[model samples]
Target: MIFDPSPIELPSSYEKVETTGHVFVSHYPPGTPAVTPVVIVTLNRPAKHNAFTPQMVRDFEKLFPMFDVDERVKVVVLTGAGKTFCAGADLEIGFGVGKDRTADHRDGGGRVALAIHRCRKPTIVAMQGSAVGVGMTMTLPAIIRIGYEKGKYGFVFGRRGIVLESCSSYFLPRLVGHSNASYLVSTGGVFPPTSKHFGDLFNEILPDASQVLPRALELATEIAENVSPASSYLNRALMWRDTGSAEAAHLIESRVINHMFGSEDQKEGVAAFFEKRKPNFKANLDDNPPPSVPWWTEIDTGRSPKAKGPSKL
Candidate 1:
């Protein structure tokens, strides 16, 4: 079941560049068109240990669609920019509080999770430092996980007074076992990746930080080289979705769609999609959505997707 890859040329669509804002964005890396293109997404906030802010999550939500529809983009690579993969959320400033879940999600309500699960192309989490809070949840949906020898993974929601928003509570237990999931969830402490957990959870572990991405890329390319383009992604998606929290995903989407329905952006989106044109959103979503008095309230599902276990999140 394990694949080892030989280096190959990256397709033209795959380009690695630094954005004007100094963000390192690797786009459409090889494997997408051939097997599953490796789309590398690095958290740009190294100063904050790549702590996922609500804005960052929102950007992710926006960026996700770019890859989702790109048939050339099959596999995805999620990592951080600096020493720490992600040190959880920025506690002092507050993250994910009163944030718009619709704007913060890759597909707005576990759509990313479901896409990751059902992606015919594979996903790999290259963790070299701490992956906490939403950071941890973000990678839970990946098919392959690689942690550096010194890397520490933590789950800190209990200490922070936040419930697992990324639905890690439902997915992590399945990945690492119930007991291990319990210890991390209850304590909000860091745990070294053990063989029992990592062996089952991570596809590989490297000796140093430098080796993590290389090894992941190697594995990605190997899979890309051998598998048929169509079959590789379809198979990967099927395998991943099978392990996801379907109910959790459904709840997420239901909430997001409800929120969107009230927004002018939703109107733009529907008209645009129907007309085969780009949407012109009226709101400045990059600044984050307005806070709701009832943070946990759900909107009426007058026109929501029917809930099916696996088909949901």
Candidate 2:
């Protein structure tokens, strides 16, 4: 099935915010009960194969926050404007190379990754073509990835004489397993999404690139329309943040369940089921959210240990 871009209406909150340049941000029309509201972020540099640049990194960092804070937004979809999703960082500008050697200097790609990771709304990345180096790693933090059979991805930092950025070290192992992550990063081999070694990295692969964004949008709509905003946001946090410990997971789950049991959205959900109609949910992130929402305020992904002070023998 072919997918056509729908007319977009920017929420009142985003009217003052600039929504142009290397990234294009737009939201699906509101009042569509059958389809959930979704915001799309497209990498706009097609001439250079949508290569990652310092400016693009900055644009991405600013883009996610707008959706994260907007109550009208329930899901976000990321994709490239052209055939390629991203050809990785631009080498001509000496990407990831800097004169500053101080401890405060941060990797541009890492900033983008962290922004996506910490975003409250669920995100989906549509990998249409080549996604290598920063391209592949930046996507690690997103909730889902849809790629086509021909799509290419690689952790090519080793071949480029650099190490991985975008916190892939933490997310890759968890998504694909330690052994696979090590092999991919160490060898820096380019591989298709279908490679058995990659496991379930791509949630679903399509016959061609044309189908990727459509499928991603379809999933986003499902989440937005069917799932409760507060529940979806908190549940995402539960799975992504607290999965490390069973006890931690139980504690958060219990709190969420207890809080949501008699909540407005929960009641509406049951009533909608029995009444055989689409329930109009009154609960939203901006207003009347369950008290247990925002279960964790701060993300403490610690920084690398600072250099030791000069020592005397």
Candidate 3:
């Protein structure tokens, strides 16, 4: 069935990313531009609290570039299927620890998280449920974060016994300040929704989920009609670099992933996923790879270790 992009008020250029029952690219459409804005990425796994698997992350990596390159796409909105935005990492699979179902699927999650943060276009994340782990990391990088009253926004890595791996260690402090970020990160799990105080993290928090899409589209359309796309993108990146923790995130992700790949947890994780059982990870992340630098301090302003150079545009 051909889905109509009209309800969300997209332009003719909007194209749907074929949803072939894969987690990576769900409800993505070709980038379209018009006076009205388009909704590109929709989280489909609501039953699972939109928990991300390796496939979902890969799809995000593939699609984010389309939005960035498509001059027409003015604003990108990210939301979940039913109740929650995303549940963060899949605890059972150990966050993309499954067998190499596809040759490239191994690191799809990290690539996807990187793409979301690096996208040049303005992004809006309308949260309604738990945004955990990579979910929280991905959300913080967006230009605008809109949380519904019923939505739960979480940074919850501390509880999992892993330092923030998904570039959040960089952006969270900048979005909410070091003390606030420290408190939230250290505390772990669901955060209190104080619209006034945490308002800095979100552009606005709606009273309920009903208001989320309309408000996001309205703002997207305003920007599409009025703002210069190039300037807007550049400005977004500056904030990402200066205020947000893009650089530090780059380092942390690289550092952590390298160590993780060599660990017993990763091996157990992969084996367990294929075995259809929960991974019995034994090694402590802290013990293997000592905590390095927080995003706010010890800045590394080099191109991402993963990025060799810009792909030929």
Candidate 4:
């Protein structure tokens, strides 16, 4: 059955967004113009080092799309509330606790990772003190990652007698190469900020944890102020999705160029350059998207049950 996604309702201020429990959603750089704002999602379980639970995983999955569909939000910054970012999953509750596995079930961390991966706006993660296992793996799907120089990261799934979760098998190698990924997964050792591997994981490392969020907000502000919302969303989608080949990318580029050539935003961008003023981008994803936008189709997972087979000899 075909169903439409429910509309997202954003609060007037960051303080008004209902957090429910461990996850807090808010806006960054308060007092900024509403045209293009930066939203922040903070993991608020500081007492437990912001350790994730199944509920936190579900909250993250729901929050990404909420901010993505909101026209006012241009970027999303994910961070932790306290000194440490996340110390991985909460061991007290245990993983896979109450889940029924009679049929195929998706990993909880994978759900959150995929949500961030599929977000239309730019997603940035700010890592603080220590991030291990699912904590480190979940951030792999973000577009940009920033952390402290003294931060610690680990992929300890091997030590726990389990495989990596959050689809890290697919994303880890892509970010840090196959050899590095293999070594990290197999060893399950912690990488300190000074380690070469740690440097590879983060885009930039600040002096300490306190600087991570500030740096992230600065970058988000730059993106929100200067770029067009529709262009940013489409650009992110094209890069993340597999275009198959160079020719496929070329075709997409041509289609986008053709659609944007005579767009209102394009004309204003040019005029602003000549006039030496900030360009007012009135085009948005909901209202004035380009004609060739939404170039990809959703994959359908429905299928018939497996047929019975004869016994093998």
On TM-score, the candidate that comes out on top is 4
Q: Model 3: per-residue lDDT, tens digit, 1-313?
A: 3232211221233344444333422222333233223544777777788777766765675566656545445578877778777787778778544556755442434466567776667787777655777777877667787777766677777888867765666677878888878777788857646533354887787787888867877776666555545445544543454434667556655654564565665676577778986444334211333243222343232122222222222
Evaluation by lDDT, superior candidate among 2 and 3 = 2
Candidates ranked by TM-score: 4, 2, 3, 1
All-Cα superposition RMSD per candidate: 15.2, 10.8, 18.0, 9.0
Query: Model 1 over residues 1-313: C-alpha lDDT tens digits?
Result: 2242232232334343223332345744433433234677777789878865655645554444445434455457777888888876677766444556755533122443543443334677788776777777778877788887677877778887866656576688878789977777788886666535433666676778988877777776665444333334334433333424777556544554455565665566677789986554433322233232122333332111211111100
- Candidate 3 accuracy as lDDT: 0.60
Runs in model 1 deviating more than 4 A are 1-23, 27-36, 96-120, 195-199, 240-313
Deviation in angstroms for 245 in model 2?
A: 2.8
Candidate 2 TM-score versus the reference:
0.84
Can you give the TM-score per candidate against the true fold?
0.61, 0.84, 0.65, 0.87
Question: Whose TM-score is higher: candidate 1's or candidate 3's?
Answer: 3
Q: In model 4, what is the error at residue 159, expressed in angstroms?
A: 1.4
Ranking of models by lDDT:
4, 2, 3, 1
* Top candidate by lDDT: 4
Q: lDDT for each of the candidates?
A: 0.57, 0.76, 0.60, 0.76
**Model 4: per-residue Cα lDDT over 128-204, one tens digit each:** 67899998988998878897878788899988887898989888987888888888889999887566655477888
The model with the greater lDDT, 1 or 4, is 4
TM-score computed on alpha carbons, candidate 1: 0.61
